[model samples]
Target: MSDSDLYATHTVENQPQVLLPYNLWSADRMLVHAVQQNHSDLPTSTLTDFGNIAGDQLMNAGELANKNKPHFQPFDRYGRRIDNVEFHPAYHELMGEAMTAQVHAYSWKNESTTGSHVIRAALLFMHSQADAGTTCPLTMTHAGVAALRNAPDLPRYWADKVISGEYDPRSIPASQKRGITLGMGMTEKQGGSDVRRNTTRADIQADGSYRITGHKFFFSAPMCDAHLILAQSTKGLSCFLLPRILEDGSLNHVRIQRLKDKLGDWSNASSEVEFQGATAHLVGEEGRGVPVIIDMVSLTRLDCMIGSTSLMRQALVQALHHTQHREAFGAKLIEQPLMKNVLADLTLEVAASLALTMRVARAVDLAKANQHEAHLSRIATAIGKYWICKRTPAFVNEAQECLGGIGYVEENILPRLYRQAPLNSIWEGSANVQCLDVLRALRKEPEAINALFVELQKAVGKNSAYDKHIENLKAAFDEQETLEIRSRLLVEQMALALQGALLLNADDKDMAEAFCLARLGKQQGLVFGTLPASVPFDEIIQRGKLEN
Candidate 1:
């Protein structure tokens, strides 16, 4: 009593405990429904297990990894040029579990499955909530398979190891390891997004290989077994696979100049490296680098959408959990009117984000067998990538506001999520790049536009606002000269229309109405908590809450 009254006067009160171990799959009603609606064949037990681990141990590891950022070890005891990046054990723990669960190989390994991409997308969506940094290599490793396909022999030797779901962090030749990861190097200092402006050179050698000499401004995941890099060859820009360690058990000529001090993604390592006559093998024909790398880039862009959506889901859950337990002036925060409105608005965002991204995943899955789906995947990916990523920073910030001061603190997860939100938008390509890609697709591939409209047309008679939005979107496309200047506006409308149509087709009419009212109708506002007063705020908030 003496100690409690003397120094413990400011005891912690009116605060919620850290969110405990919960099943991310079962807790997310919308995700579960989306999986069912998409007709995914992946067993529920798999997701249930990953969801539990992601919510508990993986989340804890994320904190520790971020707190102790990766250390760059460029030399050994004898001052040898090691050029290695070492991470905290927590980072490795997260990677091990993620790889063990087949987060990087599910879609590729289960190519015969109907909804393979959808199932894998769901895994990534949930796993990223635990820690997004490690997913960088996972994404690169997954997407790199696409680019490697251009060289059939490369896949003959690498595909098995890639789809093995074995996590090998050792800096050794791919042949010597149980499994291996692949990364990419594209952007140079002179041109961030313009691959044509790159100055790196690749010279063909007598052994049919090439010697690459230049610097990559952004060499992602330098610790990976190999990286697909673009360099200027005698013919033109070409793609090459540069390994970190040669098969002879010696370090390659690739030198890690330094690691970038990025804003977030602390658990990952991105470096700047110079190729001092690095031995490499071309992936595709010279002068066709853009097309080869574009395949890999498209897959990465899909992951960008997934990562942002995951961040939004995590932020929303954190806000909802905090509000339910924390008290304000006289009542719990969740019971407050304004707070309920904010949560309901975020609920709509998460719902729409998941719907659009999962739908895109299905399109990607079906594209291999259907032409319409292939066109839709090509065009819709750009639209969703541009809009969903553009909306995440604001979404996370509004969720943070529900917790007041605590949300901004480093000890809480919201701060980390906030820092991770912007990376997705800038990673594969910025907003403008995505917008331009949409325009390019529309111009070069008219069938893509037709496919997108056909998909949007399914919800034509469902809602008046949605129908009108579709009409306006179609009319917006008529002005060819203004499309470039108004690309963002056009892409945004496309994204909203796509999300609105998907929601209208969903079983939850109330969620669909709320999304259309807040996003498609005239009642929308610039910030969160602006849904019409007539909407069922408490019902929506209740639907969005996690059971645990």
Candidate 2:
């Protein structure tokens, strides 16, 4: 046979099409509407600009960062222990974009506004779609501001650095820079989430600074200028600010042991560190470290929720884009009835996540303003974190499968998304941690439970399916013994109930009906593509598309 004659079938180019110009905010009607209803004060112009950045330059840099994972340089050429974790230029470029977009410091920049939490959450959600790692530094910085204000004298110098929108990546003192970043050093080798079990001890010096002499197994954002760490002081566990560079412009005694070898989040560096009497400043009142750090944890957990939501959205968008382009069995994959059901089902998940998360963000804004929404957020945050993050991996995996074998390859973002999916649930807090927190919320702040119910009750007559879900949730709540033993089940129930409430309250009755029917009414199987034939596959699929 001639060279070109025998392999003619291979010559047909079966290229998978790329998804572009996907304005992360505008693409999701659910997200935009939620922002409008909750944070109307946020300038529409700002959101539009962010949407453009996320879909364009930042989106492109995301792929570049992951493609060139961070590498650790343990020592300098002169054999000094520098322990620098070097990233590609794209990583720094993304960092600059995030800072310029003001996602890292926006809430702090406009803390007095009603849109403080809402805009920050929006920027966070959109940016995480582009780059997951750099967001951690921004998160730490945002959380650090709250912790810093707790200091008796207030560390104005350091706190001001974080709030500044100038994105300086240099390793130097805050005094010499236009802006800076913050990291966290909480977890140690002894305990993961149990910061109280941390053995790092802080000794007070004559100048009122501290000498921290312990190790942090997971020191976030190694490039940051300072870290907020929990260490045992004279009174008890206290919050301390550990600066990388001291006032004298000398490198602090803290030693970066090594960079973590992790499954995902390649763009940012996490390190195991040792503090050899490194100088630090006490942040909050001595021994009130947990509450002070808890302030930070609260916001960080919200960031984690948004992180997972963005991952799921990106994965679904890619799957939707690919299936719309690729053909199989003499038709485009997206046109197949079964595929429509699957895509529509995934759409509901993404929409519900956005709705529920934004609602919680609105509550955060209210809480800051001394509104009753604080009571609701106390409980909702835990439930949202647990259920949403847990739901993410399965959604991402199935969405990846929608693209067939191409989804498994390293070149595509799907594989990276698959790797990053579980990081949110595991980081900040794990499944059991979040579940236990939910259980704690149910017991301690019963008012929060009441608020959740009140929110759900608004949709009582909207849909029979949703009404049934609310009733089932109440019934489950009454069974305290069962709830205690199976907190995950109870928490999951609470989350779905809230989502149902949001959807039913939403103007889009069709999507709401489909979600309630698939998740609450029908006895669907434990997989995607299980939407009942009674559901409007065409309407749901059309509404789900991120592309116009």
Candidate 3:
């Protein structure tokens, strides 16, 4: 009963320790298995090393970066229009680590390698868990390569810097930098996702360069050296590469209006900008902006799936960690039947998500060489993006609920995760947009539907529940005229079937069966933790938990 006793009226008894310095790769059994299944020559050490950093040091860096948000510096001390966004040192550190790890450059760098997309996807999954904000530039830089290929000269001029695996944060001409990052400026105030309605105009000058005159309502990652933007040319809307600095080392005419105080992603800076006759280089054929940029959009959509999945994984891990240590009603929370049901249900979700995401990554890798794979990648990206992003917010909310009141506090990472959970679903395209894209794919590319069925057929006889689910999906397509109205439901069923098929073929038979039962067999309730009582909760929890 001394001074310390008086201050501590009660000890902090049941609170679990903060989750840090854990191995993200080693602890994620499903991700590890998915990698082994997808890649023939796995970069084991590289992934293991990245997992360690992402789990510990990178997590701390993310906290610091978010706590100290980026500042917009529109003018210099002399009132010169510098138009730069200054970031915390931690954000730069995260960017450097991401670049050095080759998350942005991996697939393109190893284009000929087998399963390159799978490897890169795995890396992105881990990176996003640590800091989702920095992933914006990383994703854009990686996806920009796809758009750059359409312009022959643009690739030679910018490809080297984009794939340099070095992050140059200096706001200077691209030529002077050791490396560079790319950004996008598409949506306008008038047109949110409808790029065709954009008011931006691009006029050809005496030189080959074009002068772009318009404003972008959402100019993401404003500090990027260059952006692939769309503007109206004489022909029609066209894609252009607009740089922040001109070739002669003078700042371009791009004017940064102000930054968007967003709901989340505090570490990244998203700004509204106006290009006042800014010099730009046309990317592809005039009036074909949407077709040309679709390649970049596809890659970014895949990243959306990966990012959301990462958020779910981290949230589930946090929940498991909490329940394992915390106690109530004279027993550990993990041992409680209801909580175990919730935890096990979440475990199955993460496993199925990893399986489906990795499977799509493999499809992307093989797309160039195989026609079926190409079609599958086209359709599956939309489905995965739609479903995974849609599920993340609720998944994170459930995880937050596991920790009760403490989880809502700012001091914990759960609050940040909860805020970030909905961003991926809204970023690339909202749920409705994704569903429409899937319908468009079905109408335009018949081969895409065939490819999807071919993939689902791989596990046809593995489980009766999965087989029945596939049959139901096939039957739903007969009502083609109603697809647009019921697009969300159609896409969701397609997604669940894909996940069920992947899990059925995976190594863990029991886990696969449980997924089929709960997700497909109608043995579960509407929300998570509704798995049938027969499911082995203890084994599933053990499989998913991080060892303390």
Candidate 4:
């Protein structure tokens, strides 16, 4: 055969074997290790199963679903105004797998487990490893639990159904579904993060359900049985639960304006919707919309941090896989000193991110029983949401560059991962918003600051580098005059200090030292692979191996 005839054979030889069965969390390392270190009783079997679904089944589904993105349907062929978002079979298949994994409602079902939130974080991190669109609704549902409690009647009403490990996508009332998914519509066009400026109005009705008449600029997963929305009332901004189907078995007056042409996250539907006196149930008090929804927003913000971290880990793993297999300069790529440095630093960066994020997750799991944990979770989520998400885009791009041309193409997941990276930082809330939230927490809730400091203080004496970073962060807090001007700077310092503290407390002394030197010690440059030459590169890189 001619050289061209060997195309298929040649392609096979160069392609790297993928790490599957959720190799990222197949072992109790990194984030999982951090979780087990604190919560020793987390079921080992559940972790293994989650790893299989994410690394194997979900990963396969992710590959196909992203290839076949969802489409918006304005009307049915019979001229019926059935606004629906049509996704490829693979997308639904992936959603089904994710729901079966109970990514949405598992934490609620396992509410008795002390490590429930950490387990949820692990599952969410693993599940989103493939596709993130479906994870959004699940996250909304999970978060909805916290906000749902405000409406005392909602618990018995939604508890069993929301906690059901089933993915019923029927456009029917929540009562009729085998299981139900949840969504949220908060931001409108005029106000992206400034939800207080939302002009949507809600009028009380005789039947107890309010009539919401306005538009939501961005409504995710429109097919969800219900969405918790925000609108203006006589009492000011309030939260309302808007269902797709009203009690009379008729579609609510939710007129789909159009679907958003988002930059990435193609597997889910984000729509612009108009409610013409739509039937909605009031969720908390009349004017407590922002305060009520803040619970849900905080959870989604945590999801954003997890999502960004997942993207970075995937990119790093893919880079590691390619470097280990592909060859150049008469040697294997992994053997190349330059590439090894980059991978090792990436490994440390991702590990530190996972540690800090999981620390928040642990606090979340323990929060219901302990107010201190809750306060720590509140502040940790804000700091992580800002720093980790902001770092994702650059980290993904660096990982992509490691693969050169191949990573830039659609054939590999890097391009898709890169495109998906920015959405997390932008989603739920933007970086600036999170930084300000950190500032707000410090200003209004001194308890939260103390909570955060308590957590950071855990690693204070372990390492001078980490302790110094914490001191720097404390000094920034003291400078209230320039706090706003240096808000981002201060948040960055706080986040880094927190991550540094977590690493310093971690069992992996080498990885911790490397992280402090590269990140906190200022011994590295702006880009990856800038770890100091004296650092032990082999142990760090090997620890990052997907198989390990």
* Residue 162, candidate 2: alpha-carbon lDDT: 79
Per-residue alpha-carbon lDDT of candidate 1 for residues 386-497, written as tens digits (9 for 90 to 100): 9999999999999889999989999889999999999998989999999999989988999999999999999998988898899899999889989999999999999999
Q: Write down the TM-score of every candidate.
A: 0.98, 0.96, 0.98, 0.96
> Model 4 off-target regions past 4 Å?
1-24
Report per-prediction Cα RMSD to one decimal. 1.2, 2.0, 1.2, 2.1
User: By the lDDT metric, which is better: model 1 or model 2?
Assistant: 1
Task: Tell me the spans in candidate 1 whose CA falls farther than 4 Å from its real position.
Answer: 1-7
Model 3: residues with Cα > 4 Å off, grouped in runs: 6-8
Error of 3 at 381 (Å): 0.4
Question: Could you tell which candidate, 1 or 3, scores higher by lDDT?
Answer: 3
Cα shift from native, residue 95, model 2 (Å): 0.7
lDDT of 2 by residue, 438-533 (tens): 888778888878888888888899888888887777787766777778888888888888898888887888888888888888657888889888
| Cα deviation of 143, candidate 2, in Å | 1.7
Cα-based lDDT at residue 225, candidate 2: 89
Worst ten-residue run, lDDT, model 1?
Answer: 151-160
